[model samples]
Target: MIFNIENSDVKVEIPALKHYSSDLLSFNINKLEVNYTGNSNPSIPACVQCSHPAKPMPDSYIYYFEVKINSINSTRPSIVIGFTDESFMLNKVIGSSRKSFGLRSDGKLIHTAVQTMDYCPKFTQNDIIGCGIAFISQKIFFTRNGILIGKAFDFTENFPMFASATLSSPQDSVLFNFVGPFGFKLDEVLADEKKVFNNQVQEEKVDCRNIFYLVKEYLEYEGYPDTLQALEEHMDLKKTEPSNSGVISECYKSLDSSCQNCETQGKICNFCTKKIIETVEAKTNIQIPEPRNHYNSISLSSLYLKNTDFLKNPSKNSSEHNTKNLKQRGILRQIIITGNIKEAIKYLTEFFPEMLNDELCMLYLTMQEFIELIKSREIYKALDFGREKLAKFRNYTVYYRKNYDIPISVSHAFGIIAYKNPHESPLAAFLTWAQLDLTADLVNNRIMMRTQRPRSCLERVFKHFLCMENLYQETSFVKIF
Candidate 1:
């Protein structure tokens, strides 16, 4: 009867050995050599395009060993194979029943049997051999019988086994033997490399001030500096041309003199001469008195006259006559300030011929009253006053242009006043006519246009007036009209 083993199904042929002894005979396995020539037939499906016909070893086939036994005795048989020290031993027993043993492709073993007699027989064999017990060609552990005997072989066709006399376990040293040449001194080598690296790091440190200075120099050479002081300093380093040198010299020469004009060879151009004229004129007019002078004069009496003896008898004292004239001038100035233009003009013509040149004073008083009339919407009064002033100034401008050869700026002032007056005033029409004649004179070289501020002021005022008129016309009152 054929009996299958416990684990692996390998077949074993057992022949009846009829020896009458109680000792079971063990097979001679010390020189056992099992040869595996690979699979007998190609295990992989045939691919017409493949260059090789057979499937390779380590994938297609596995080889292992098996054993079986039968006995006529009534007792059971047992077998054991294992390693002791550097040697291998196998022991076996036979009984009356059949027995079987199996060895898997993975190097494990299993057995099955039953006894039929009262006596037992035993047989054992060790050092059974085959190709190195391996799952893959590279993962082979070579053994003789059940004991490890040699190093694993490459088993790959072209590769040969490499040997080294200095085999060391991984735990034996600081570095693994697998790490080729620099393994032993790895820590020392790394420390040296790190030291050199730190030296490079120290060498790469740069002083910020030196870097900034170099950058500044480069920028100045390229004609741009980060700061105004750097730019000025760079410019100062450049060579000066003759013209620039001359200008500097002239500036220094001017600064050294007390008076720039005194450098000219004129006896009348002394600093004292300039000072004496200004002092005399300043004392004479005394119009815009200093704040301290005004404060001091605040306590003076408001009496109309201190002495009338000069009025009663002018020829008795020249100083008395001077006092009379001063009183008259004061009264005229009061009228001008009161914006009584007609009365002021009459008084000035009768008493003060020299004060007629006070155009700014007259213009100031006139503008104040005129602007009040405009705000009050007294259109007729504003037009009347504005027209009278425009006519007066226009005549004065013409007279100045014809007689003094000095261009008067009065026309522009008159134009501005007339333009600001109410629309009912014929003054703007008159101003336009007068401006045409003035413009012609200006073009013909008789009058200077620069002195005339009237044109721009008139244009602005007229445009504003026209805009107001349009707005008024759009209202309900105009719609009803």
Candidate 2:
């Protein structure tokens, strides 16, 4: 049973009044408006609180509510609009305790009864006052009508804070716009805060820029000239190497020195050819005979081919002969990306038969092929493929280990057959582009390991940070990915 609809979006509701001091205040039919009925002392105001805490939106990191002054009962109507913890007394002013914060209509900011400061201009009837809580900075801000006033106070506690208001004058009423039809364009405020947070994160992650640079270096080292060229062009970068004292460096120098002679004789010089073969043998620790023709030896030139289009112009030594291996590997990678498992297997068999010897790589390819069949609703074929290829790995302990709980197992993956629409199942997280990307990356790593090349520096860094994230149960480091 695969469901097609996505459920990534979240819904946030507006805060509304739950209950208040019944003796001092009265509410209309709807709890959105409150009025002072009994005489509350000017200093000890009647407080009304919303039903729920001002919970931050997980993505936006803020919560906000606004109140419009509907009427004033006295010449000095001391209305307070702010937030307070549940422990605060409802019979007292909202800002009369340390656990509460408020902006009074008289243009004063108060955190405790004894501590008050001149904050902003005083508000009168018909003025909409908004109070917002910024969780990241732990600051409270106010707005008059639709204009933002400066922040008033900072709190260090993590207690739940509820939206609240206090009235000091009899018959003074205020209307709350919990979920709006708002007078203020709150979207702009949210955007600005998000931007500020991102800037702060960017400043802290200065080293992350080098990770992409490492990836660029890896593409070049792996002989992906086209991909390396595209990456350089897209990011406006230049190619750079970390070291200049390896067999690779010597080989490059030898080729450069002999380029003119090879171009004249229409074939690579034997010195440069021998260096290329030695480089491959050093990396893989596999001995091979010296090739009489460097252009025709698939075993020696598979990784060293610079120009794959050499067959079209054998007489021209400066053609695509150097990139032949890169073109073949690139095609294989594209085949995997396109989810053409059969074509990928055939390509590997034809060019890099050694990859088929990797059990893990074979398993990932077979699993991807099974998933493709499942996606096409070929249930009989999928079941047949699973029984033939995946049955033996049903209880494979390596995949089911606590640290590596892959969902695509015989027991878990076969459960999809029970659903009419598999995407609706809890197991649907495995049926995503993320899953395909994971398979492709695993196969690519296997290929790189088979060639005995060192793992990419970017991959090493990512794995290190991911391990740190798991060990400390912190997500900050993994956010870069």
Candidate 3:
């Protein structure tokens, strides 16, 4: 579902969130936090949106908000952020039901049973939590301050869910911040429901040193041994010993004992393998041989075939070949990208017959289905179906589509077309080879073979993130095709 984060004045009503309150309990906002005063008969519980299609929010549309526990009267007070289909009750805590899922303040996940306690950051008071409810993925996430405490809950049942909270003591209360003390740029906050199920959130340290391995992988894959060797020499890297590990990734294996890595408490040391490697290295000074000369490369332009071919040949045959090579019009590309399934399929049959095959058909059909949902304005079902379908292509051959003469990766391409009216703006005349040409050369090898396709890299994601350094930022949500 699309998010209108531009609305800053919106505030979640305290009454909607409270499922039940002790008759003596009173809730009020004090110092920017929701505060509750109760005379000790259990506590008050609350909810925000408790059903599918709650007002402006449609089913399966991801809803996000921030909550801060400003202060609690009890030292051992408990706080809960939970989801459930059941009605709120006075004495009930969120995880009391089999259908309900809850994340407790002490970092425990409570459903019918207490799962793990140490998985999340524990907070006492004055801490903010970024809470996200994703109906499409049927999962929830809680961010501690800014650090995203990943998927906290997954409820399989299709019943409507209400975002709920509970206070452990008469003194306990929590404030809802629909707007936020945001840790990340608003642009990075997820709005795309499709990315909810597939989205991977990782916090990795930026290292310029990693570029060396990236370049090494690139040169080896592209058959540029000479240039690679020159780079290694310039960088003063030691000539690596030829590996027996059979790994072709950026990281190489050391001859460290496998026992060191795999050993539990009492495994015996296996020194035989270590001894062999050491003895060989000591005696032979083992290293990969230097890269060879350029005799192997045969450029297509190198062969000179009687440079006067066009001069001698008749114009009639040449004209026919040129006509055969003519490209399909820009309009056909537009139709395919704009969700005109029937027309797009027709063009495919006439031009790219191969794209009408099973794989492409399945891809287009899925895209068409999602487009129908968008047209019908069924954001919930559209998000649900979209996630389920794209999950299959997790082990994707997205790179195969890099040969754009074929199609953009069906997953990425369809996403752009899904929201955009191909009839207008940038997409109307946007199939420029120059842009695709630059991207094709850069990221192709980096994809490699993977158990799962990665989300777009940060450089790619932030390329269109127009904001800079805090204060009244206006950033664009870019759907990269």
Off by over 4 Å in 1: 1-303, 308-320, 343-377, 395-408, 418-481
lDDT of 1: 0.30
> How do all the candidates rank in terms of lDDT, highest first?
2, 3, 1
Q: Against the true structure, what is every candidate's RMSD?
A: 42.8, 14.0, 24.3
- Evaluated against the true structure, the overall lDDT of model 2 is 0.66
Name the regions of candidate 2 deviating beyond 4 angstroms: 1-14, 39-44, 55-62, 73-77, 134-138, 155-159, 186-195, 198-202, 208-287, 291-481
Instruction: Give lDDT per model, in order.
Output: 0.30, 0.66, 0.45
- Candidate 1, which ten residues in sequence have the lowest lDDT sum? 44-53
Clashes of 3: 9
lDDT of 2 by residue, 377-402 (tens): 89899889889988876664212212
Best model per lDDT: 2
Which has the better lDDT: candidate 1, or candidate 2?
A: 2
Candidates 1 and 3 compared: the better one by TM-score is: 3
Per-prediction TM-score, please? 0.18, 0.48, 0.34
**Lowest-scoring 10 consecutive residues by lDDT in candidate 2?**
308-317
Which is better, 1 or 3, measured by lDDT? 3
What TM-score, to 2 decimals, does candidate 2 have?
A: 0.48
Off by over 4 Å in 3: 1-21, 29-34, 41-61, 113-116, 179-481
